[model samples]
Target: MTHKDILLVEDNPDDVELTRLAFEEANVANRMVVAGDGAEALDYLFARGKHAGRDASQLPAIVLLDLNLPKLDGREVLQAIRGNPATRDLPVIVLTTSAEPFDVEASYALGVNSYIQKPVDFEQFVWAVRQVGLYWLVLNHPRVA
Candidate 1:
């Protein structure tokens, strides 16, 4: 988190590998850390549980969160993040396979920075990942011009 890694909160192993490969193919330099469940994701962000003693102040540059997850789910995680002042300003993007209107609307309502439906095609998915990484990590600078 201190290095501004891209935190990917996903339970599906295949999706995790695909995203890692996509980011690699896209040549994104930022490291990606995986949290297999919502509770684990929160633990990492708050530096609790197994991630204890880690500095909580240095959060990830961005989070790619999946909605369907075990142990708390993405909505709960997002709520916890937004509710805490320490992580309220963190940029969180909902990257899920779900394209349901409710999911999209709810994510925005929960203060998500972006809602992206995981593209079915590999090439398209890679492109999406590349654009996302480029925009968030390089082109867009919230603190500096």
Candidate 2:
């Protein structure tokens, strides 16, 4: 709503750069705000701490979440988001290196919109990120206010 296309919650810098490159390659002119940890992600979403006074109505079209985070972690973050009425239906995609069956099942059970495994190869990773960005940014219809 605030001209941001995606909220990418990731701690790794390399992955973040790769994702940015992929989005650029896709030509999606989206305002991306990066949160290094789950706590920061919540702060950004809830407009807490440094995000205080920010507009809460400016929810991103999609959230690219990583499962393993420093503080709260992705599972707790997802739970918090789902528990909140304001962000209850917000679309979330778990994009991480985790491909464990339990992780996949848990993410799905916890109401993730989608789960994507990070590709190891650089080119493949870029391609995957491009696909994700294109789909979520261009094709997906979020509850735009």
Top TM-score hit: 1
User: Taking the tens digit of each residue's C-alpha lDDT, what string does model 2 give over 24-111?
Assistant: 7777678788999999999999889889888887787789999999999999999999989888889999999999999999998889
Candidate 2: C-alpha lDDT: 0.88
Clashes of each: 0, 0
List the lowest-lDDT window of 10 residues for candidate 2: 136-145
lDDT (Cα atoms) of all candidates against the true structure: 0.93, 0.88
TM-score of each: 0.95, 0.93
Q: How many backbone clashes does candidate 2 have?
A: 0
Cα-based lDDT at residue 139, candidate 2: 84
Question: What is the C-alpha RMSD, rounded to one decimal, of candidate 1?
Answer: 2.2
Give the range of the ten consecutive residues with the poorest summed lDDT in model 1.
Answer: 136-145
Clashing pairs in 1: none
lDDT of 1 by residue, 98-128 (tens): 9999999999999999999999999999999
* Candidate 2 residue 20 C-alpha distance from true site, Å: 1.0
